[model samples]
Target: MTKIAVLGAGSWGTALANTMAKNEQDVTIWSHKAEQAKEIALKKTNARYLPGASLDSNLKATDDMALAVQGADIVLLVVPTKAIRQVAKQLGTILEEKRQQVVLAHAAKGLEQKTHLRISQMIEAEIPAEFVTGLAVISGPSHAEDVVKGDLTAISIGSTDDAAARLLQAALANEHFRPYTNSDLVGSELGGALKNIIAIGSGMLIGKGYGANAQAALLTRGLVEIREVGKALGAEGETFLGLAGIGDLIVTGMSPNSRNYRAGVALASGKPLAQVEEEMGMVIEGVNTIKAVVDFEEEFDLDLPITRTLYQVIYEGKTIDQGINDLMTRPLKAED
Candidate 1:
């Protein structure tokens, strides 16, 4: 069985780890919080993030990074974007000492706030090259809430390294979980990250009492915006047409389970951004993604009306109605 180390103990991390363990892999999950690690190990439940779901009894949990990663064949990163570099650095030090070569895969979706780097780029910047056998990104329409309930979930495992991608595909796939391999890492990563912004827009529309027509229009336009920006950033346009692109957008943009979408609804309900985030008790990646993508648009001169308008509503204290007005009033152009 493949030995796997899953970093981060949030809902996504725990769900993925439990899946691996149930697949008969030797899996260990790391949580920085000692009490959480103990709880998962002893109680077989991650109560804080993944409520009511029973983890595999065989799964192990640890607060010690070295213990979690020891003899691991694949190191899966499921941490938030903000913690990518820090976790990579720690993993690098441990791997260098162990002299282990392992596949690296990240499931997190978001760009770095300051550097605007993708999750893989941030990991590469901190990790020593010799210890990494391959790098892949896992993203698609799957949600932890559904996945744990044995819902059929399909996701793309993107990597330039074909063998590594196939390896992950084999290790993670089951009757309920399907993993497809893709070579367009940039497109895959961008598709996942960028869609969160649109999902927030979707939530805002719901909050403003808009119906399906508006959501359909928003998603179509948002997809175009994502494709254009991704192309400018060196991703293949066609990648956005696939699961990593439209599939993910559809699920996240429409689902009440999506944190970003909920964040938007809360924002529209007149709650301050800080208050909404506090109430949610999760990272809400779209908020940070907006800041990062706005910087990218400014630097590259890309036109992203939805993202731009959300920025104003979120950070500039503009009302949701005013933001909608601005988007509707933009100079008319042919649908790109």
Candidate 2:
């Protein structure tokens, strides 16, 4: 059996461990909290993150990074984007000497806030270059809750290294959770990061009781903004139209399980952003991604109207009504 190390014990992390465990892989999950590791090991469940979901016996949970990664063929990072660098730094200290052919897989979906670096870039910066055989991002319309229930889902595994990408496709693909491979790392990462911002807008519209036509308009406009930003960042244009872009956007925008969409709904209902985050009890990545998008817009001088409106609402304390009015009053243009 292939030995895999999964870092982090959050919902997505635990869900991934569950998936691999069910597939009969020898999976070791590293958790920062010893109690959480004990919970997974003793109870065969991660009740906090993956409530009511039982993990397979093949899955082992540990607090020691060295033990978790020892002899692993691949390291699957499911930590938050903000935590990527810190975790990678810690891994570097422990695994610097390991010469095993290890493929690094990440399920993180946001860019670094100030640097605008993708998670893979952050990992490369923290770890020795030669130790990283390849980097792959697995993303698409995946919700942790639904995935744990074995719902049919499809996701993309993207990497610049073709051989590594194929290896990931083979490792992760299954009857219920199908995986497709892509080589456009920029497009894949950008699509995953930017969609969260749009999901917030979608949730806000739904919370305000907007009709389907209005939701459709927001979704379409959101895609344009994502594409513009992706292009500015050197991503291939057509990649945004694929599973990572349109597929992720549609699912996150419409699904109640999406933390970003939920945050948007809370914002629309007149709740403060801070309070909404507290209520959600999970990281709303869109909030941080909004900041990153604003920074990117300013840096590239790109006109991201929707993202600008979102920034105003999130940071400037602008009312949703004002934000929506500002968006509607903007000069119109032909659909590209």
Candidate 3:
């Protein structure tokens, strides 16, 4: 049996931990809070984030980091992006002290707050190579809520190392869950991160009572912008056309299950960005991603109309209508 340690008790972590348990894989969920970990261990339910879902009785949860990482064969980092490096650093220490080489896979789907580096890149930078045998990332259209409820979900694993990706694929694949592997790290990471930004924009459109036509237009154009940006980052254009690219985008941008989309709705309803995030009690990745996009766009001298407009709205206090006007009235250019 493969022993997997999932760090974090967030919705994604709880749902996936349960799924792994259902698959009869030995899974342990670690939380920073003792109460949260205790609650999961006793109740088999995470009410705060993943309400109304039953977790497997065999699944284990704890607040002790050492217990989670010590004998783990696979350490799944499911914490927020901001917490990733901190956890990885701590993990590195334990792995070295105890002398364990584990495969590291991540479900976190945003760039580093400061460097704009992908989650895998951040992990690589923090974790010692001797402690890590391989690295992989999991991302796609699957929502945490739906996955726990046994809705059919298809997701992708991306890695430069194919053997590592296949390991995760074989362990994760089952009747309700499907996994595909891709060798393009850039495409998978960009697809997952950039979709959150576009999803927020799509949510803003919905909150403002814009029709489906406008929302559809935003999604299509957003893909174009993302494709260009991804290419500049060394991702292939064809990658954007695949499941990691367009498939993830459609679900995240259009689904109410997406936190980024819900955060956009809150923003459209006149909630301050800070207030919205605090109330959600979750990392609104799109909000952070917008800041990263603004920073990186200047570095690359790229024109990402949708991302830039969302940035102006979120960071500069521009109104939704104003942002839309700027987007719709940009100087006419032929579709590339």
Candidate 4:
């Protein structure tokens, strides 16, 4: 059995741990809070994160970082983007103390603020190279709510190392959960991260009482913007057309299950960004990601109306109505 350690006890992390354990892998989930860990391990449920869901009996939970990764062959990180550096630093320290190496994969989907580094880049910078066999990212349209319920899901395992990607694929895939290997790590990571911005926009459309026509337009244009940004970052255009790209965008954009999408809905209801985020009780990656993408747009001098509008609305105190008008008033251009 592949000994897997999942870092984070949130909805996504807990769901992933449960799925892998059900697949018969030896899986351990680690949470920073001892109480949360005890709840999952002893109570067989993570009510705070995955309420109404039961964990697999075989899955283990712990608060100690060292204990979770002691015999881990594959370390899958599912923490928020903001926490990646800290978690990677802690994991690196534990690996160094044990003198052990393992393949590392992250499922977080956002770039770091100011630095604008992707999740994989953040992990690589913090983790010691000698303690890592390879690095990969698992992403696509799989939502935690659905995945934990045994719904059929498919995701992309992206890595520059073919062996590393294939290893993760073999360790995670099952009848209900399928993973496809892809070498376009850049595209895979960018696609998932960038789509959250559009998902927020999608939610705003519904909240604002817009019809299906507006949503179709938003998605189409949003994808064009995503592809453009991915291209500037050295990602393959074709990857944006695949599961990690369009697939993730569609689900996260359309589904109410997406935190970012829900964030948009709340924003459209005229709630302040702080209040919306505080009540949601989850890290809305798109809010932070909007800043990063806007930075990218200015640096590259690219036109991303949706992203810029979001930044203005969230950070600059611009009203949602004005933001929409700003987008609608932009100079006409042919669709790429």
What RMSD does each model have against the real structure?
A: 1.0, 1.2, 1.2, 1.0
Model 2 regions lying over 4 Å from their true place: none
Whole-model lDDT for model 2 versus the true structure?
A: 0.88
Provide backbone clash counts, one per model: 0, 0, 0, 0
lDDT of 3 by residue, 188-300 (tens): 88988888999999999999999899989999999998898888889888888888889999998999899999988888998898899899888988788778877778888
Expressed as tens digits, the lDDT of each residue in 51-169 for candidate 4 is: 89988999999999899999899999999999999999999999999999999999999999989999988998999999999899998998999999999999998899899898889
Clashing pairs in 4: none
lDDT of 2 by residue, 3-93 (tens): 8899999999988888888888888999999999999988988888888887778789999998999998789899999899999988877
lDDT of each: 0.92, 0.88, 0.89, 0.92
Worst 10 residues of 3 by lDDT: 288-297
Our model 3 lands, by Cα RMSD against the true structure, at: 1.2
In the predicted model 2, the residue pairs found to clash are none
Task: Please identify which of the two predictions, 1 or 3, would achieve the higher lDDT against the true structure.
Answer: 1
Per-candidate TM vs. native?
0.98, 0.97, 0.97, 0.98
Q: Return the lDDT, model 1, position 321.
A: 95
Give me the runs in candidate 4 sitting further than 4 Å from their true place.
Answer: none
Please tell me which model should have the higher TM-score, number 2 or number 4.
4
